[model samples]
Target chain A: MTSHPDVEALAFFAEELLEPDEERTVAHHIETCALCAATLDELTAVSGVLADVPPVPPMPQDVADLLDRRIDEAVRERAGSDDTATETGGPVAPVVPFTRPKKRGFNGMNLPRLMMLAAAGAVVVGGGGAVLNAVMSTQQESAVGGSAAPLLQEEQAEEAVPDAAQPYKPEIVGSGTDYTSKDLADQAADVLDATVPESGYGAEEEAQDGSILIEECAVSLGERLGVRFTLVDDARFEGAPAWVLFAPMGDTTEVYVVDPAGCESPDGVLEQETFTTR
Target chain B: MDAVQELPDRELLTRHTQGDDQAFAVLVRRHRDRLWAVAVRMMGDREEASDALQDAFLSAFRSADRFRGESQVTTWLHRIVVNACHDRLRRRKARPSTPTEDDTLDVLSNDRLGRVGGGPDHASQTEARLDVHAALETLPLDQRMALTLVDMLGYRVEEAAQILDVATGTVKSRCARGRAKLLPSLAHLRNPHPPRDVTTGRGGANPS
Candidate 1:
């Protein structure tokens, strides 16, 4: 209070965090003190600069798409398993609590895998240095459905993936970084959009209003990734319904072939692949 | 459900918990950007921010029902993101980077050439900001988080207290101490007042 309001006092003064009398004392002293005044001005400017740091721009589009897909998968995985009772005419749980499930893989979205996929996602998504030295990603590199040897029969896996799934190599939009669940959904939507024209939906000119379809798919993809295939409309691809699927790898999102009459786990048809149906 | 996107975040959250699947995504979309800003600055690395963001959102989705309506969803989300970033930072021990090889001049040049005005003064401002950012990393984690929430992110001290789960006095003291350390780091950015000009022993203008 006496020995010329030190740096803390100057900062508290700048921040208005001092007692009223202390504030007055600092103000009066600063009025006569150039050094403290300059110091306060500097502190104020530092705060200004920190505030000026720009907001990271919404995880970019690709990342958002990826995030959506992941969330969808998690939602469906939970719903798919938890709702089995309802599916079998058993009593439904009265409450749907948003509690964190046991530390088990919520359809393969365990913490370690989520962390691993995020690292792989950042790299494949392309941005930021090899974050964490791709540390987590490399640990589970094979399980990610990225750079993994096919776990299923090569023929059936190839059959499931099909060359059609290869035609439209995803442009993985925006700066490659931060693949959120929504971002994954958007990536799936991209596949859906690209698949429409290929499914004989129409020509480029006819289906130009594909915006509605893409929008529908984007929203629907989020809720139905691992849940029951909600046969989004009667749209068929390669004589089968195109379904939104969450690959076991926990990151890939694709519109894959679904047989409604024989609804089955997608893991059977495809093992660790990101591809489109038909 | 067209209004789903337009509903208050609380309502959206309610709908989400009540089984409106798209509701959670809407909430995430609504708040993700600002939360991204928090995560990026706190995590101090782009990838770390991304990872933390993913965990935060997933946690938010799982924990939405736990929100007892005590605070704005934004505050709730910010806390989650901060906690996520803190976890990553702890795991990585990624120190706030020093000026190892990235010179201030290099940072200046990296700015859009035409954007930052050509002058030593503009360069100084750029360097000062970078320095402040680097300096921020040097603080202890608690001080860093407190300073970040109050100063950098513009959260109210009370709200920061809630987010950090600390007393307001604690936030105030942290800011005070953090600012005290920061001032010296930022002294060059302050008006360069000619080194006191008191070597004349005349005590400059103020003879006191």
Candidate 2:
């Protein structure tokens, strides 16, 4: 009845997802309308192009091995639970891999990725780690080092994995270690806009001032969010309260608004505490 | 692991459910290629996809009892993987950035992409492939999954509906909308009487 069958109809026509009568109707419409016919062609082209994408290479063997170990552990635990159930007739609970993983502001980093980061930290500069270090180093200094330590650590690791001999907790996002540039950086999808707390740190004396500890902490956090702290340019922007540090990763710049109050509180800046980076 | 490598995915999954962890490894090996393809395409980042794949396999291992056997084992695995990818996508707040043509957009996937600049032939092909991927990233998850299953991965609409646990009409609409979006996003790839109609596998592909 109608001259146009719409995109769904064209898609159905391309995939033969239509009824025989519907198919004929769409085909007949295509024959009469150049736009419908052309639309069908474009949809067909998209399908063709998508189909051409090469399959991703197989997962790295080491990661596969790690997964195998975890699964094996789960199966073994389940077997143990089954044994316990048979002996005591108690209901067996499923083995949760993580304990309380859903914490606020904690990036749900996979265990293998954490392992990779640990491995990268211990030896070779992993591509991911380098990227992570460059970006996360500064952010960690600021995000967690401030009065937010209790909030950050509130979501502490329950069962810390013994990563490479060190009893490392995967949940501890801001590893204080100075990370080199990037093999293992977390890809930050959207960096939150700066919501700098109003304070009395805008005085000229506070400009170009911040501690090395503050810079390191910021780097630690920023690496997790893909922002590498390159250098600290003084708080030059108009009406800026704290010393501003610009952390440039690839093309985007993460403006770290340093609280002169040494990351104390919303009330004030802590002396001449500015921020710098590696 | 090598002995069970040839076993069908269903058999391997069943054995894994029966507490034979090694059987799962065989299944993993068998489907790694296709699994990687689905995850990489869905998640757009190899690292993110890798994490999602691990999570999916683990979830499958843990919840093997829930699979009702209404669909193919591959489809079930894909469904779980797609859901996990969606979780990561939701967690990763940024809209995925489209990579430049020459950018090694998939460096972490392996060494093959490292050698991608194999003259104009490979260069253009890789660029076109990346373009489609970027376009796919822009679509809504439901629409993207529908197109991915029905069009990209060569599943029928009914089969995709089964995999996604949605009505067939939903899958059709989603695929259609997805295709609609891709048409303009990939306008550069389209041409009059395009010479390449034969993709080896998947929808509307000319039989070779």
Q: What stretches of model 2 exceed 4 Å from their correct place? A: A1-9, A12-29, A76-278, B1-11, B93-120, B192-208
After superposing candidate 1 on the true structure, give the runs of residues whose Cα lies further than 4 Å from its correct spot. Answer: A19-28, A85-278, B94-126, B194-208
| Tens digits of lDDT, candidate 2, A1-278 | 46688776787687677889999988888888887887788787887777766656776675566556545555554564444433432222121112322211134334333222322222111112222332343235324353223222312210121111110001112112222123112111111111111111111122112333444334432322223343332232224334433444223334444454444332222122112222
Q: How big is the positional error of residue B171 in model 2, measured in Å on the Cα after superposition?
A: 2.4
What's model 1's TM-score? Answer: 0.53
Q: What is each candidate's DockQ, to 2 decimals?
A: 0.19, 0.23
* TM-score of candidate 2 chain B vs. the reference: 0.72
> Each model's TM-score?
0.53, 0.50
How good is the docking of model 2, as DockQ? 0.23
Top candidate when judged by TM-score against the true structure: 1
Task: State the fnat of model 1.
Answer: 0.42
Put down candidate 1 lDDT per residue, B95-169, tens digits, no spaces: 223242244335534552544443566655555455556667667677888988888878899999988767898
Candidate 1 interface RMSD to the true structure = 8.7
CAPRI class assigned to model 2: acceptable
Candidate 2 A-chain TM?
0.30
Hey, what RMSD does candidate 1 come out at? 19.0
